[model samples]
Target: MKRTEVSFDIETIPLTIRQFINGATIYDSSCSEHAKTLFVSGSERAFLKISKRGTLEREYHMTKFLHQHNVAPNAIAYESDLDYDYLFTEAVSGEDGTAELHLENPRKLACVFGEYLKMLHSLPIEGCPYGNRTHELLNDAQINGIDLNMLNEFSYSAIDNVVIHGDYCLPNIIMDHFSFKGFIDLGYGGVGDRHYDIYWGIWTLNYNLKTDTYRDIFLDAYGRSNIDDDGLNYFTKLNKLTD
Candidate 1:
């Protein structure tokens, strides 16, 4: 109820959309402390997210960019009104990677997760607006009320950057049966170091599966040669400050 008050004031939604969603089955799908996400199902399937004003601007733009690349959902609308930001998007058709089917087969799940991450990293960053994530991450960590000493001060200048799903966790990955459908919850996605994504990919698998058994399998599937142990470790430390 507090989330409804703080993030989503139902009256803030446009009238036509509000009427439709009021009649549809609405499910609370929030996963972060910063926002509220709702899944609406009925005549049309869609997701509506609300957060503090101006907070969803980047997600709106990033989703639009990735949609052009065929890897994200189409962003339908974005509006900032009455101290809240609202974003509407058509839903990607599939269950997330954490679904029982994917969870039952760890080996297959790890492979698909690794392979698809590799594919996302291979995307061209030519028109990406969020290419300065490394610099931004450092700055964000320093001033975001987190202890600066907790962050790794490693120089990432020499590493090649790629289009990364900033939050490359299993829940953000959608799978239709065993195949990768698309990605969701891409608020932090953009051009960044590959190891950052790899770090999350490995972490998510271990966290979701409740074991570290698939770490090497995931790395190998993502092309072991491209992985840098030091980079992954650096990101592991850096993530604490951001999280």
Candidate 2:
């Protein structure tokens, strides 16, 4: 996540959050156009995200759920008014995977990336509330008026269902010197096909590092025996339509 120093009008902020970050350093930590994320560094470190009301409900709940499993930052508070939603979360320790320190060593980055993904997939999903993401994605694409005839032609091969970090990109996976810390931006996370996360893992490495050389290494580290080529292709096409 990028954190360029920025400022906010204290008077315009909601009273609840305004009090939370009083006299704190603020930075624009947002990566998405739909929301404004401000990082606060005062006596307490926290992130406050402001977005259209009702838009942050899933992320708020998901963050709290993942925190119980010790894989995400603790959600501090969530509030909504007539105009917007505010979600505050404690800062997780460590830099995002895109930090120069991690990106410098592509080999180790890919290995740890794959290893951590496997660790996430190993998590039990007995109580996860969002377990129908594949159908939801297809439905959302249709709702957005994107044609899905191509996706209709192929059958997605089955894999053991496991917990998935819906957007498992380098920036969302936090780490400290190659050790896993936590995952953020979990609006899309839940019980889903493992290949969806794998597809993103491969995509992020290639997109951020500007090379596809580590795709095989990542797959190997994650264990090739568990992967299905057809499943990867299925999600690739699905993502294109959804995007």
**Full-model lDDT for every candidate:** 0.81, 0.87
lDDT of 1 by residue, 104-172 (tens): 999999988999999999889999978877767767776877665543365444243798888899999
Give the C-alpha lDDT of model 2. 0.87
Report the lDDT tens digits of candidate 2 across residue range 60-163.
Answer: 88888888889999988888989999999888889999999999999999998999998888888877878776667667888999887876566765343888
- Candidate with the greatest TM-score versus the true structure: 2
RMSD vs true structure, all candidates: 3.9, 1.9
lDDT for 108 in candidate 2 is 95
Write out the backbone clash pairs for model 1.
none
Structural RMSD, model 1: 3.9
Off by over 4 Å in 1: 1-10, 15-22, 144-160, 241-243
Instruction: Quote the positional error of residue 174 for candidate 2 in Å.
Output: 0.9
TM-score of 2: 0.92
